[model samples]
Target: MSDNSSLLRVSNASLLPPLVDWTPPTFTPAAQARVAATMVLFVFAAISNLALLISVSRGRGRRLASHLRPLILSLASADLMMTFVVMPLDMVWNVTVQWYAGDGLCKLLCFLKLFAMQTSAFILVVISLDRHHAILRPLDSLNAHRRNRRMLLTAWILSALIASPQLFIFRTVKAESEDFTQCVTHGSFHERWQETAYNMFHFVTLYVIPLLVMSCCYTCILIEINRQLHKSQEGESLRRSGTDMIPKARMKTLKMTVIIVMSFVVCWTPYYLLGIWYWFQPDMVKVTPEYIHHLLFVFGNLNTCCDPVIYGLFTPSFRADLARCCRCRPPADSPRSLDRLSARHESDPPKAT
Candidate 1:
């Protein structure tokens, strides 16, 4: 009787099928909209960034870039990298509806995403510092361009280092009891604070510190410009001899600085704020965050679109070059402004020791 019972139990167990938390594999309209929106954003970002790169890299645009070669190149490169390296991975994730690339690629994707963003932030900070140097401390310090290039290289290396931790802590796991995989930070419960800690760290590093640095630099730049303009105005001969052009140039640069910083804050603040809120109140997960997430990401990438416009706004030389590229004839009557801009670019790159 014992042997028969054991056989029956074994047969009954064998008759049961394996368990799988499967859901209907139908594509929802919501998912389709998300993918479509993301695709459009990616295409726009890629084109805008590529145009900025081309403008700064070749032909007449190259003349304008020569004055600030390292920063211009670094800025364009950072944005271009996002459109290439990061956007494609994001698009794939949206379309697949699963993290099917396994753990290794998931970590890599997380790393690259963080690296691109952090590097871009770092580049913005450096650009502000470069502008400060060019304006307030106008003398060349031997190999200034070479030093700026080194700074750009260092910023990239540091960004990678900063993002490296994500690879170890983030992983691919099945969502709850679902059949699909999720790439997310591994959970812990020492104080149930892992998510908050990571989110805070990222927010502070990528957003807060860079913003502070840029803010301080631009403030000082404005003060210096005001003082210099006051002194130049006190001299009547300086105005007649076109020496006032220095102050005008400084004012133009300050305008661009203000616009870029404001645009950066606008584009990035919502995303980081939402991330912090989610991490701090994990119980609020029931709240509909999909639309919020989509909106923030789309705006975050709008910065890439805005950079080219910022360049053209403050730099007439760049406007002329951009016009050439677009095959839009610049005003036949605006030759004087364009010539002055060209003259400024050539004379501006080098300074007496």
Candidate 2:
């Protein structure tokens, strides 16, 4: 009886459970579909952004307004960052189901992910404001280059500043029970409310503020344009004098930017709203299917693939640029092509007379 009791004590000690329990994340069918969708979005965004960047840097896009080039470049740069940073991070995180990289990479990548998102939102705001200035105060166009430079600088700075918190909040947490680690914000906030507050702050700044500013700017622009049209219609003498109250080129650019903004809102609103619902009702995670969030995230990434397509649709030069690139021709050296591109650019806007 004494020997049996000794054996039982040793077995009980050996079978003691870990302090913290962890269940290893499974790669479900929904996760698999997400990875596949993410890969497709990444490829399309990368190619489209690279093409748009090349078109603006060396191709006929040189003919675009000096003030406008920076906006397009900044947009493309932000989207590329999303493609290279966010999409890959998401794919790897889902596939590995745990943190393979060390603590430092975890924080840095989270910072970059937030930074890219902020930059994308802020740059769109900047573009809307620029359009507002261009339409309402055309006489101030000479200062647009300096004005746009200042705005772009501020956008980048603000994005970096806002995203800096990720450096401290995100870290690699080990689950001793499963002997696995994950990059998460598990213990960053002492209270649950603190984490909710932090997320709400980001959500407001990232989506709500930008959406409001853009909507206001575009509304004012439309009102001004309508007033101008009404004035022109009523005044036959002004029409006969060959005065264009609004530049046709500016209008085309405005239309393109508006479409880009709409795409951003439409693609992201559902995802963001769902996130808010989940944050407020944590139990929704158990009640809701995982594929719902996965699909929403995939849909949000679709916005990155929309911008370049919108630009190409509005700009005739982009079509020519695409053709030249596809044919593997020297875009800059073709005088005939340059002339044709020049003609198309000028012809896109109507003459006042």
Question: lDDT of candidate 2 vs native?
Answer: 0.77
Per-model TM-score versus the true fold: 0.80, 0.87
Across 32-81, the per-residue lDDT of candidate 2 in tens digits comes to 99999999999999998999899888887777777788889999999999
Model 2 CA deviation exceeding 4 Å by range: 1-19, 240-244, 328-353
Q: What is the lDDT of residue 239 in candidate 1?
A: 47
RMSD of 1: 10.3
Measured by TM-score, the strongest candidate is: 2
Candidate 2 vs. true structure, TM-score:
0.87
Which consecutive 10 residues in model 1 have the weakest lDDT in total? 1-10
